[model samples]
Target: MERKSSSSMRLPPAVQAAALAAVGGSRLQKEFAWMSWAGTVWRLEGQSGAVYVKRAGDLKDERDRTVWLAGRLPVPEVLGLFGGFGDDWLLTRAARGVPLSDPSLGWEPSRVARRLGEILRDIHALDAAGCPFGERKLGHVLIHGDYCLPNVLVVDGRLSALIDLGLAGLGDPQDDLAAGVWTLQYNFGPGHAREFLDA
Candidate 1:
């Protein structure tokens, strides 16, 4: 199977040149998990840190607006965005934290499960009253389309950063809670899954 290069997404001249330089016009070496249908995933290393590149994802405008609006919120920063690469390409700064899957956090399944639940709920509690980004209407919110343990990063045994906003859209907070439930089942255990879900 031949892997596709999402080079067609629109990009700023500098970003395009950087992409070309990063992949050497051959093929990118890293691929992140599935977050959406619009673009190809790749581990993009930037001057700041590891960045996940979503090419042709049609999220350039939404993401730009959302991040810009949520700047005060506890989300990753948006680095840059482009629309000339043939597809909409969005560049977001990677959040700081180890994935929740890291065994170093806690051995007890219930403990981590509860923590995950609280973290997400807290994020959803952010005041969206004056939110500048119309993501709720534009289809970008708390419930990630592909929310999973790998997409969440935990640092010092606390939820720190979240990745893969490809599915960010408007929906009930339970949507994220449900996804967290499934992730908890996979990470912690089926027994404690409901705790995270019910939270």
Candidate 2:
């Protein structure tokens, strides 16, 4: 993500205050500007640690899913969620790993594809008995609605964490598999999508 001045993307006063409080008064840097949604992601580094503050039109869904999946999966820890001024702000501790989309990670396509498939398999195997989100259709399983490479993080070639859970819920496993296939093709070129599916 490119670093940009927080001033360039004016956050609502209340959301700004909440973010500051979550990070104990740190400088906010614009990390990502979402194109698919009307949202902005900011990073804050403070004495406590690094945290991410997300501002969106609505974040309650993400917050709820993240909270529910806390112990069941590797995901960011929620710091706070605030709503005001026509926006919702979500503050979470930064996941500790590089996104697969980071070219600097130097991941081999075949191995990464296998690892992604394994991770998705584990996610699908989670018991969905008490899941409070997503429509329960036939053959539905818990899924990460957006399972693209950028959302999956890795450390030492192992899955570290998953982020951006706004679209997570009980859904067909194919939804996640299709996303993984597409991400593999996009990040590592063709010929890896089938490997990801088979692995």
Predicted structure with the largest lDDT when compared to the true one: 2
**Which portions of model 2 show Cα errors greater than 4 Å?**
1-7, 25-38, 84-86
lDDT of 1 by residue, 18-134 (tens): 554543443334445444445565555534346556667367654754474456444667666667555666666556787776676654777777777777776776655544433
In terms of TM-score, the best-performing candidate is 2
Per-residue lDDT tens digits of candidate 2, residues 1-199? 3335544666667666666676665565555534345366777666556777787788988999999999989999997788756678888888899888777887688878888898898889989888989989999999999998888999997889999999898998999999999988887788887667887
CA lDDT, every model vs. true structure? 0.60, 0.81
Residue 54 error, candidate 1, Å: 2.0
Residue-level lDDT for 114 in candidate 1? 71
For model 1, the stretches where C-alpha displacement exceeds 4 angstroms are 1-13, 16-38, 46-49, 84-86, 103-107, 132-146, 167-170, 187-189
Ten consecutive residues with minimal summed lDDT in candidate 2?
Answer: 29-38
In angstroms, what RMSD does candidate 1 have relative to the true structure? 6.0
